[model samples]
Target: MSARTLGRARGPLKGSVSVPGDKSVGHRALLLGTLAEGTLSVRGLSAGQDVASTRRCLEAMGARFEDAPGHLRVLGVGLRGLKAPKAPLDCANSGTTMRLLMGVLSGQDFPATLAGDESLSRRPMERVAAPLRLMGSSIATTDGKPPVRVAGGTPLKGIRYALPVASAQVKSAVLLAGLYAQGETAVEDPFGTRDHTERMLAFLGHPGPLRSDKALTVPGDPSSAAFFAAAAALVPGSRLTLTRVLLNEGRLGFFTALKEMGARVSWERGGVHARETVGDVVVEHGPLKPLRLAASRVPGLVDEVPLLAVLCAFAEGESRLEGLAELRHKESDRLEGTAASLRALGAEARVEGEALVVVGPARWRGGRVETRGDHRIAMAFAVAALGGAGPVELSDAACAAVSYPSFFSDLEAAGA
Candidate 1:
């Protein structure tokens, strides 16, 4: 673990920046490409540790990857061509890797075991495993968590399932396993989540047509764009342009929240890539009113809750973010972490049942905040530091490398 003190910006942040490729899209592309019938080429893949974990796991299963600067050419092994790994697949800290790969491994002809680092090991696998088990796959877990074991070669029967919770990972895992099932596999989420896997599958020529309401392209990660947008919106005189950002409706909850709060934000449509809509967004400093987010909207912006909490800290009046129980299971207890970070920076925030309430127009008195080994928490607080009263000391700042390898550098480049 490492620590750093981030100082407040001396002037308004002004610049244009291109964030790294979307982590969610990058992971799905590599995983789906590994199992596709022909060669697949991916541009602007994320160079982050979590996505790298997925690549390495796929390689362990005999998928060939030819890497270039900013691009990847994957020769997929066909749907049934993967060989069992000689050892247990180590998923490191990526829950997405572990959960999603369990689906891929379920239909193989050989048994497979998946394990991960401490943080990932604590995440519940049963949300994914229970459904896989329903598909006739022989799978087991240690008390519903990691160290998951799957006995492959079992024929799967696709069945319709309604998600108990709205989760892109669980939905994607079921859909991936559906590729090997005997019939169409369907998952319905009343509260929609990100659809990167579905979009990438369609792009790669999946035979079925998705629901009309679910059509998509896996654009740039709007969650990543939230950090920069916050810095520009909260820091006086700050004006920044984020290029080629994903405008997926399911992933735009944070931006919508900002707009509802009266932030000075606008966008122009750009071209599409990989079946994902892309656009350039301009954000500038402005007065933000309080926002009340409903529980139904939580799934769309679940990843951005920490950043939204930070933005709320600087906005006038109280902002209540509801439907955040899922945050308890992320890389960290993000709800607790978000509130702690805000309190450490002299803001008033607390959890009320499933909602996080922040009383703001905060008078920031910068102090040390713990990252708890969460990338989003670290990045959110770092953005908060840009408009703070003094230097904000962050413990375990390096954890941001998990999702955004160049986050600190990008922050500097944007003059934050």
Candidate 2:
């Protein structure tokens, strides 16, 4: 059963919360590692059901896995070592799992079919499939939706492609397909996006040489750290440190936006892992001011928009977020769900074309929030509920389990 928010959090949210491991990396570690030689051991892995779908898909392709709570041991099948599944691969609610898996399957010799839940079935797969098709892989979709069929052994060859918009998943799909392609595959993002897949790929020893300085290269995911950052800020007197967060130029845009808006966020003990910036973040209560956003920084914080909206609700002044046109195609129209959730909490929000404007520190009262079955929306509202807004009841709270199965328990551990 779904849990209910009784009232605003009144006590000092105490203790340390080791939030789930990076969902993006956890998926990559399982999938890519399964494709490599030798055994792969993943620690602090996300137990989220969505990532689990990736693990299961890999296992179906001849990759054996022994999962122990937070630790997962996966046996690698070497390059091009996957076996065709006996049945269509069900991706559940994960677009990432399905899209990226297509890239992996594109370079193989056997056929595999990809399908998913209603939400995943509705997402556009054409973006990745078109690129894969260009690489000589024969892939078909039902009217640009899921239940995708792939006929492998297409002698894949890579080509440089420009992104119509900045999307990590699309870029990652192309890059992963490039792994087994005959030549170099380069993705040119005029507007850069997240590089978690790239960084983690490099960390695991298989990333292609990336050209930087023009784009905000993938930075470590502060998206995963956002919850604790908010927790530390809201918990009053709590000082929680987020260790080893990637600080790629593209990824740090969130921190930059938040800092500009007056959130008490900072980086500590910066280091490098396989050339990517790694650092810690410390957050405390501060008078958060409103921040302005536009095209240049939108792609960097795309995944964090929902949590950013929650922060906007608690900030002083009007927070403006623009260039969200792409948010429309995510698991749900995030722009609409975000604004609608704010309105449910008695806050003021509006959408102008692709931009969203939120007026903050408004009374967040009780109301029902329709999640649209998106994981981020489900989790974002959970953070909102801690504001003591009158009984914020969420419909489809189960959605959070997709990316963060223990989200509520972690929030509780942090004294929410």
Question: By TM-score, who's the top model here?
Answer: 1
Count steric clashes of candidate 1.
Answer: 3
- Candidate 1: worst 10 consecutive residues by lDDT? 209-218
TM-score of each: 0.96, 0.90
Q: lDDT of model 1 at residue 327?
A: 97
lDDT of each: 0.86, 0.76
Candidate 1 TM-score versus the reference? 0.96
Stretches > 4 Å off in candidate 1: 208-219
Residue-by-residue lDDT tens digits, candidate 2, 110-146:
9999999887888888988998888888999989999
How many residue pairs clash (N, CA or C atoms closer than 3 angstroms) in each of the candidate models, in the order given?
3, 5
Expressed as tens digits, the lDDT of each residue in 1-416 for candidate 1 is 99988988768889888888888988988888778776676777777899999999999989898876655787877887798899999999999999899999988989999999999888889999999999999999999998999999899999899999889999999999999999989999777888888888888788752212122233556778889998898898898999889876677788888888878888887877767778998898888888899999898889999988888888889999998999999999999889988898889999999899999889888999899999999999898888773588889999999988889998998887
